[model samples]
Target: MTKTLFTGVLSLLIASCSQQDDRICEAVAKAPNTISECVHREGYLLADAEGSIRDVATAVVEKCRNHIIQQLLSKPENGPSLEVYATAIEDNAVEEAIRRVTEARSGNCKKPE
Candidate 1:
């Protein structure tokens, strides 16, 4: 009976974590600019515990950066210059998201012991 209860609890926890991750990803995809809000929402869902927020944020940033790079590269007529690419990256939503993630990781969203 004890083993069954433990198994059930573990299953529920895993399901809850999966749901939270899905919600976070959806929010990021819907509004990449609103990364801070999404991070806060996920933090709340996880009770401010270290719950894959860093990993999710990193993945989001990488995907956004790759998409931007591809878009720039595809525009041969525009002759994408190094300065332009640097500016685009600096002024992008992904940078803001990464900053927020760093702040959150160092601040209130730290891993629980």
Candidate 2:
């Protein structure tokens, strides 16, 4: 019984630690600021077909969409599936994430001075 309890506790600890190690997962698990930073570090800006500059964090977000969905779904509040979340952010989603980071950066990031 003691061995089983110890193993369960150890498993939980390991899982928590592993989640912290994943930047994208951590961001999704944390506040908006962290999410913005994570997006910024993994994304950039690009000119859209409409000749407007946009953040390209959508690709990064998409790349980690599955992980993000899983993490979010782990919480009782976010009960959406991966496909639902993907559809919501499919259009310029990375750009939106990048925009958040850029907004928070306030000219501190790659934005031209």
Candidate 3:
């Protein structure tokens, strides 16, 4: 009984540590200033596409989409079949990224002088 309890506790500890290591979204979400700066840099590279803020935003999100999906999949509590939620997750992630970039550009994602 003691051995079984120790194994369970150890498993939980390992799982929690792994989840923390894989939490890319959590890290990004926590660093608003960093996200703003990254978006600004990416947007500057695409500055030639004037009047297409959405396109620039989409490109930035696409750059990070794979990492986002990988982070989502790493969560032990997520569904077993990522394929089932892939479309919805992609759409939601893109929409949210665009919204955030747009908001930041208006407020904080300024070109550094």
Q: Could you estimate the TM-score for every candidate?
A: 0.30, 0.32, 0.44
- lDDT (CA) per prediction: 0.48, 0.45, 0.52
Q: RMSD of each candidate?
A: 11.0, 18.6, 18.9
Could you tell me the TM-score of candidate 3? 0.44
Query: Cα miss at 86, model 1 (Å)?
Result: 4.1
Model 3 per-residue lDDT tens digits across residues 20-92:
2222222233222333434444443443345566776678767655555565666455565666566655666
lDDT of 1 by residue, 61-95 (tens): 55455455555555556666867765665356445
Stretches of candidate 3 off by over 4 Å are 1-51, 75-80, 111-113
Between prediction 1 and prediction 3, the one with superior lDDT is: 3
Residue-level lDDT tens digits of model 2 in 1-113: 99999999999987764332222222222222333343444443321212223424445575546545554555445656766655554444565665644443333233211
Q: Give per-residue lDDT, candidate 1, residue 48.
A: 38
Candidate 2 regions with alpha-carbon error over 4 angstroms: 1-37, 44-55, 63-69, 72-82, 86-95, 101-113
Give lDDT: candidate 3, residue 59.
84
Error of 2 at 27 (Å): 14
| List of clashing residue pairs for candidate 3 | none
Local lDDT at 53 for model 2? 34
Candidate 2 residue-wise lDDT at 6: 100
